[model samples]
Target chain A: AQSVTQPDIHITVSEGASLELRCNYSYGATPYLFWYVQSPGQGLQLLLKYFSGDTLVQGIKGFEAEFKRSQSSFNLRKPSVHWSDAAEYFCALNSGGGADGLTFGKGTHLIIQP
Target chain B: DTAVSQTPKYLVTQMGNDKSIKCEQNLGHDTMYWYKQDSKKFLKIMFSYNNKELIINETVPNRFSPKSPDKAHLNLHINSLELGDSAVYFCASSHRLDTQYFGPGTRLTVL
Candidate 1:
């Protein structure tokens, strides 16, 4: 079964500091990867996605992720995170096909210290 | 205009009762999905419909039925709701297997 692992349950970073959220997936073949952010009491917003394209993919709110096939990882990174960036970050994978649903990680709670 | 929306942002119901959550998307997407977010914030896909046709039912219980009235609307009906059913439900839509846009979510609390 395809699964996602987000090692960090929670991460704390100072405002305006760089941020990186780790994500690893277990799948038989290369799958579609995505990053989503959910603010408190709100729905999730797609930050970015990786299909068949350049390894490094950029997303909204200055977020970016790199799909390293060899590493089986799709880590989200931000040059500088604002306080508004503090939210739950989830890494998801879809193994193609219309019947397949996105397998999401446990999610990492980002806390931006002001 | 909201791209995707779910009715009744909050719902409180008693166990064994029946309830429904409605979802609609104006993005003209062909696929609609239902996801459950537990208390731990673990999100899982319960069902997916493509063009009003059920395509994915991820071993969800029969008590939880998803009805896609049309290509733009998908509703989830829960029967005999249990305490464990208390969580946030999200509706999402996309163009086939493309990026999905999500609704604000409905928080269901079964007491």
Candidate 2:
């Protein structure tokens, strides 16, 4: 079974500072990757997805992630984060089939410091 | 318009009681899924239906049953609910195997 591992349980970044959240996946083949953000008491919102492309994918809210096949990682990055970016971010994966559904990480709690 | 919606945003019930949470999606997607988010914010897929047929059923207990009356609707019914079953249940839909759109989620609190 495919699984996602987010090494960071919580990360704090100052406003206007760059942030990076590490995510690694264990899948046999090339997998579909996604990043989702959820605010307090809210549903998961898609940040971005990576199917097959240039490895670097940009998502909503000025967030981006790079899929490094050799590293088995798809880490989300933001050059400058705002206070509104403080939320729970999840890394997910799917093996490209309805049956596979999606395997999600435990999530990283992003805390923006002023 | 909400792409995916789940009814009873907050549910408070006692143990051993039966409850149901309804989910509907207007995206006309062919696949729908149920996921549970625990207190620690760990999300896991429980069930999935494709065109009203069960496509994926995870290692969930038998007390939790999913009913898909149509392609656009998938409802979850829990019988004899336990305290461990208290969590946020999310409904998601997608066109085949693409990115999924999630509902607002139903928070179930079992007393």
Candidate 3:
């Protein structure tokens, strides 16, 4: 079974500062990876996904993630985070089909400090 | 228009009561899924339907049943709900083996 691990439970970053959220996965083969964001009371919004071809996948809201095969990691990064970027971020992984669905991490709570 | 939507954004009920949460997707996708988010915000897949067929069913309690009327709608019904059943249920849709789009979620609170 494929599982995702997001080590950081909560991270606080000052506004306009660069941010990086670490995510690692355990899978037998090459996997599909994704990053999702959730607001205070809303549903999840897909930040980005890595299907194939590109090692670096760009997602919505100026977010990007690099898929490292050796590291088994797909860490989300942003050069400068705004105040609006404060939310819960989840890292997910899927081996193949959507039937089994994607396994998500415990989620990382992002706090934007002024 | 909402791409993927679920009914009763919040559901509050007591133990032993029965409730149903409806989900509909207008994205013309071929698959739909149900996921549960616990109080601690840990998410797990409950069930999945593809083209009106059960494609995935997790080790959930028998009280939870998923009914797919068509490819565009999947409804989740819980029988004799318990306290442990309380959580936020999310509905998602996706193309065949593609990125799944999620709904706003239904916060089912059992008191």
Candidate 4:
């Protein structure tokens, strides 16, 4: 079965520091990858997605993700993290179309230090 | 303007009682889905409807039923709620084979 894994359960970083959240997926074919961020008591917002072209995809809120096919990984990165960046991040995978449901990771909690 | 929205942001009910959560999307998408996020923040897809037809049901209990009156609306009804059923339920909509848009989510608590 297709699945997503986020190895780091919690990550603490200082403000203005660089950030990287790891995500790895298992699927038969080249998978459609997505990264979503959820703030406290808020719905998930799409940070970035990787489909076909360009291994590097940029998303809203100054976030970027690189899709590595051989490694079966899509890691989210952000430079100069802000205190408001403290939130939970989830990595999800889809098999291609809307017909298939997305397989989500357990999520990683990001803590921004002052 | 909310692209996808769910009613009753917070619901507290008894174990044996029944409750309903409504969802609507203004994006004119053909597909809608329900996902449950547990206390550990692990999200899993529960049900999906396409064009007002049930397309996917992921091992969900019979007590949980999803109804889609139209392409833009999907509702989830639970009969005999259980303590284990307490979780955050999110509603999402997407155009055919496109990125999905998620709602604010409804937190259901069974007492």
- Docking quality tier of model 3: high
Residue A75 lDDT in candidate 2: 98
Model 1 per-residue lDDT tens digits across residues B1-111: 999999989999999999999999999999999999999999999999987788988877899999988999999999999999999999998887888889999999999
Cα-lDDT of candidate 4: 0.93
Model 2 clash count equals 0
Give each prediction's DockQ, rounded to 2 decimals.
0.80, 0.81, 0.84, 0.75
Count the clashes in each prediction: 0, 0, 0, 0
DockQ of 2: 0.81
**lDDT by residue (tens digit), candidate 4, B7-38:** 99999999999999999999999999999999
Identify the runs in model 2 with alpha carbons over 4 angstroms from their true place.
none
- Writing each residue's lDDT as its tens digit, candidate 2 over B31-110 gives 99999999999999999998788988889999999999998899999999999999999999999879999999999999
Task: Chain A TM-score per model, please list them.
Answer: 0.98, 0.97, 0.97, 0.97
Model 3: DockQ vs. true structure: 0.84
Per-candidate TM-score against the hidden true structure: 0.98, 0.99, 0.99, 0.98
* Model 1 score (lDDT): 0.94
lDDT (C-alpha, whole model) for all candidates: 0.94, 0.95, 0.94, 0.93
Q: Candidate 1, residues A1-114: lDDT per residue as tens digits?
A: 899999999999999999999999999998999999999999999999999879999999999999999999999999999999989999999998774678999999999999
